[model samples]
Target: MVSTSTLTYSPHHLNAIVRGSGFPILCLHGHPGHGASMSVFTDHLNPRFQTIAPDLRGYGSSRTRDRFQMTDHLRDIEALLDRLQVDRFLLLGWSLGGILAMELALRHPDRVTGLMLVASAARPRGSHPPISWQDLAFTGVSGIINRVVPSWQWNIETFGRRSLFRYLIQQHTPLAYQYLADSGMSAYLQTSGPARNALNAALTAGYNRLSSLEQITCPSLVMAGEADRHITADSSRETAHHLKNSQFICYPNTAHLFPWEIPAQVLGDIDHWIDRHPQVVASSEVSSQ
Candidate 1:
């Protein structure tokens, strides 16, 4: 069963969901989205690990908070851990969330047991903006579709694909097709809410803080899709280089959402790494028959 709770983070209440029971793992989402992005991992975790997926402050059920800097997000994660009374758990971040997880590991190493950065770039180089505003435009449209005609939310396919537009239309219900165009317009008119401004600030801060990647010291896994257009393979390689101990993996023919498309392979790699870690192995050996 899924357990949902409201967490009071000062000015606003953030919604958090936890399932399974054992070691805690915090999962983050990407730009223009929320913790639901971690839905791909819903069925792929080790039985010994409990999963904690939160709607980041500015998205989904979480109330938008002030101070959307990378540091701010890190603090939020820390507080969330404190609320849960958990210590030293693995951190997984996808896309924009990957950057956030990286920051969390760098800033609060004591709280992170390991790091997994999925389809994340070390630096947002080149003319393209660090976070795509265009993607947000489409995401906002999709959210409005959810609010008006909730049933349309059922067909949110192709989350781990580059061609969101094509998949969305094909899977959309009759009402969703209409709501995306209509309700999306209304939602756009009421834009610039706490979430938008907060995310924009976070994006700008992320671009500015790209150089701090070298400070990370953890067993890290850097993953990227072979066909990720936003952040190319070159940047992902650069990201891996910055970590003290890291492994880089590229999923062939995949886009930014690798875990969603191939959860088994992704989870298997993660399990292998965790099992091979010196501390984990040492502990297991002591308990073995």
Candidate 2:
């Protein structure tokens, strides 16, 4: 729930929200999302875990002077971690942030105590896959609504950015999941269009780390929404298969923005997962949870 402090870090000025006082937990948001989106996850964790939610380089309030790569973001997080003197911590990421978390754990396995990936995957578009008839059924009426007279298209074109930002945060979630639409407006609006495009380009441009995921040996928790249009639950299952020590969970009747859909459950799951991994150990020595 913190995130007011904005500090200038290397590559770009990194604004972050550091709250609570316990084992550190660094949270990262998805593409076109800022650090604030992580508030849904970090808000309650403050009492049990120290949460560091930083706006990634070229994201949110961070300045996007030029096109940035995936590596640039990793460096920013590393620098911020170093600056804060956080030697080791748990990592939680959603969507694009999950990809980065995997990369970070691979690059520095010793530093990441554990990992929590929500509605995300190990690969790029492979995470989303192709929407099947079953998924279409899960989408139900919302799919028809969007296809016929999408709120996003209309808001962006006619209502201007103010309206567009609100819908974009919802990400076309069905009516049942649109209750928190207003809460996410600040996150989508702060991020620039170039930042979103760059992140998309980065994901689509040969961004596959499925093969390399086996190199990471940290305790990992992977969760996905059952009806997530952007990233499918099956893709998340595939990701868990590649990991040596990982647990996977798929929430029914949920979408890409599942955390917002059910905040209490998300927090409970995270707490239970973190409690299981008090000490980081290699997969060879312990069984996957």
Tens digits of lDDT, candidate 1, 185-237: 43334332665765565456546344676677768888877766656666887
Angstrom error of the Cα, residue 250, model 1: value is 0.9
Candidates in order have lDDT scores of 0.61, 0.70
Instruction: Give candidate 2 misplaced runs (Cα > 4 Å).
Output: 1-10, 126-182, 280-289
Which pairs clash in model 2?
3-17
Q: What value does the lDDT take at residue 177 in candidate 1? A: 43
Give me the overall lDDT of model 1: 0.61
lDDT per residue as tens, model 2, 221-247: 999887776777788888988988999
Error of 1 at 2 (Å): 34
Best by TM-score: 2
- The candidate 1 region of ten consecutive residues with least summed lDDT is 1-10
